[model samples]
Target: MENNNNLNNSEKKGIGRRDLIKGLAAVPVLGALAFSTSKKNAYDQNLKNSILRELNIDASTPPPTGPMAGDPVRLGIIGYGIRGKQLVKAAGFMARSEKEKLQKSALENPNDTRLKDFMEQENLNVRFTGVCDLFDVRAEEALDTVTTDDNKPKRFGTYQEMLASPDIDGVIIATPDHWHAPISIDAARAGKHVYVEKCMTHKVNETYELYDAVKTSGIVFQVGHQHRQTQSFVTARDVLRKNVLGHVSLVQACTNRNSDNGAWQYNIHEKASPETIDWQQFLGNAPQIPFNKEHFFRWRKWWEYGSGLAGDLLTHDYDRINCLFRMGIPKSATASGGIYTHKDGRDVPDVYHVVMEYPDFQMGTSQEKGKEKGFTFMYSATLGNQFGGRNTLLMGHDATLELLGNTITVHADPRSTRYKEMIKDKMIDPEVPLYSYNPMANGVDGVTSATAKYFANKGLLFTYRNGKRVDSTHLHIREWLSGIRNGTKVSCGIEEGFEEAISAHMTTLAFKLGRKIEWDADAKKIINVTEEEINQCDFITI
Candidate 1:
């Protein structure tokens, strides 16, 4: 309880920029020059110091140890909205100096009890190069928060200007769903690594464009499915790998929150207006509409910008299961639900459900090669009630695994084969969890907003590592930056993002067409639509 209190306080106070760059001052120019001799290494200490100096990071601060402590990466932020601000905060965690990090370690001398097992997760340190947003207020706010001492981020009138900037090594895209693919493609083509927020892409065709761009540019592209870093999902993946759960036959996931924010009724900024916001830029490829404060603030409520529950909520729940089980594209999907809760002028549904069929895939090597048993993946979401909270459950013959934020619980199945002997010997009981993994030894309760709590409980917002809570957003960003520096694939790379995008699109199509949609993996197209029917539909090309 005491540790959890410190956790909350640390979040509220935030880590200062001094703590972030203090350690870099100790690295000498000759030492950096010596390390730059390796052809495979991208770390240029002098160049990093110059960038830090420009950012107003004091050069006199002591240098601490880490992979890229002396060499920081230049980052430009695109779309400085809600999620973008949160991502920026997470990036700051990655920016903390190793010396400052060690000073807070649990073993050394924790200022709080929660510091145990906490070490600053390293990134190729990050320096904000610029910020881009359609809203002047949002852009200015983000620029101020992300900048250091006397350094101010260059304000870009458009995303293209930011992407074209030579000072930026990469860009983080947290724009609306529609702009993800286009901005990502542009960033890649501009020779910049990309960390793009989820929903992957808006139009189905653009998904392929973004995928191809990442491939062509050979850039490290990471989808913002930060849940990939959640310890519960990581443990669940191991459980699946161990074959202790037997063959998972059915998976259930849900998103339920009863709040104005959860329903996409975000508060409009007081400064929002035609003059303050570039409404034309925000419209992008969407149908042109006159500037309206509600439309600009509550964009997610409409289908023109957001993909409804399927893309916004379902994609999050589905991606975690996909990561755990390695479930690629589904065979077919059927969706049902409606805008039963929010009666506002929204085109998307407030309550939704989808069922996707998966072909028999090998869950274990022990299973017969020819034997196959198909399974169903289910996703349900509701904005009217916050009854059960959000979670993912995978049921198997041997046991059922329940995944919550930082917890993974496995309960025995009565008629299990693999666990039958243990059950009979009284080593395990069907009513009790056979195994449970909880990363948060000191629990956090009611420290955040209801909507934030909803996401946190679902392992989407933050995760625990080595008994200490760490922002998954930071971990995901670190992974992307590390991959770029090392020339390796990221956790949620282009192919993974493509798979997620296509799967979500299938659900969206199913809801839109009011019919089951089947995937023709070989042909790479939706099978149920005819050439004429495709033209008749207006949402997006399949």
Candidate 2:
């Protein structure tokens, strides 16, 4: 999902050779496209059809006229963990509000007996039929939270038992990363829609497996990369796409943390005893080790269960960047870092920097005429606190964009004379917000008298561009529901999840191989490997 603004700029320039050249020059050397017998045009057409079919309604239908109609989509949550609780809460709120509005409207119009009867017969609120977890306490807690008389959700011990129930319409998976693929595949096979968390799966091959299952099962599947749904990111993509900063050349995105907790050093609660924790269930496919409370709760520290900082933090950045650029997976990846700070027995790296290559799809040797260049993307993340904050930098051909948490700044590339002049003259309208001093303030104040007074008294100031602030949390959930309701194409769907996982795997490969790694995207494997060779050599496994 490239920014609409950026698309407009590409259109304005006609995606010229100059743009292609700029992109190719910056990308890493190991990254190169290998065109073969496969018809690229045909493949793209198939992808378009797949996207259209996934979203049940066609482009002509225009998103369910008036208000969202039909019986409230019955939903079944299969996990009672933090994320599971969040889904129930958010979905429940939306469902309740929508139902209230319909009922109120029906009551106000007394003549409309059909409308009144419809409200009574078709309950608009979601019917949470089932909740499941291995532990009875967790299952009961989840059931207690969803105690709505309009729709009382049943509780169960195992996911299989819950899936057997005819009442379930969909499943919200919030289990550990390792369980993500298995549970999602099972749910899809059982003919249920799935809203799986980010990094979609634990291993590289599992992504393909899950993708096939979802496609074959004809089910709605959404990966939980919530920021994709956020208004802020949407607005930023739009602003950048419009060439507000003039031809972006380079992008730098990072997530920083100083505290141990911020880096997944979760505190163990006193209640986290063997009685409350299901040791065998938590272990799942992971090696059968003795029950350790820390491993059960803060499993992110262990490579056996989690993809470390790369999957947790970097994946979010990758998903957001991909949406902004309208690009897919990189050709090659390289990374360097270590557990330099906390020596808490974590297997994965505590800090890391990775460079991903997006080869120039159009570039050709001087031998070929009418050829264009491609683009490159570079990203990094670390635990060490630096520059005193977090940010995402988008570098382009004419200008460079720096996007801090709630602010964005654009600077001209020193090499471009025209870009420099544009910057000097401020040819770009000042209507686009610029971050100056007093960075703590929220950037979206609508210029009211109270806001003016607050800024004047505190010497605090910021500007709001014609940008939409994204609520990543809300968007993530809404996108999941939309995928369920309309069978819409998910922004961070299976392909994206696979692409990100592969990128992370390649980073580990490059670090271990101690050389730049190349990939054969067509074969879906590293180019030099033999049939029997273990792909594990490319990953950092515990």
User: Which candidate number has the best TM-score?
Assistant: 1
Clashes of 2: 21
Q: Write the residue-wise lDDT of candidate 2 on 146-209 in tens digits.
A: 6676878887667777767788877888877778888888888999888887668876667778
Clashing pairs in 1: 23-62, 23-63, 106-116
Span of ten consecutive residues with least summed lDDT in model 1: 57-66
lDDT of each: 0.77, 0.60
TM-score of each: 0.80, 0.70
Candidate 2 displacement at residue 91 in angstroms: 2.0
lDDT of 1 by residue, 198-239 (tens): 899876778878888999997889999988888666556767
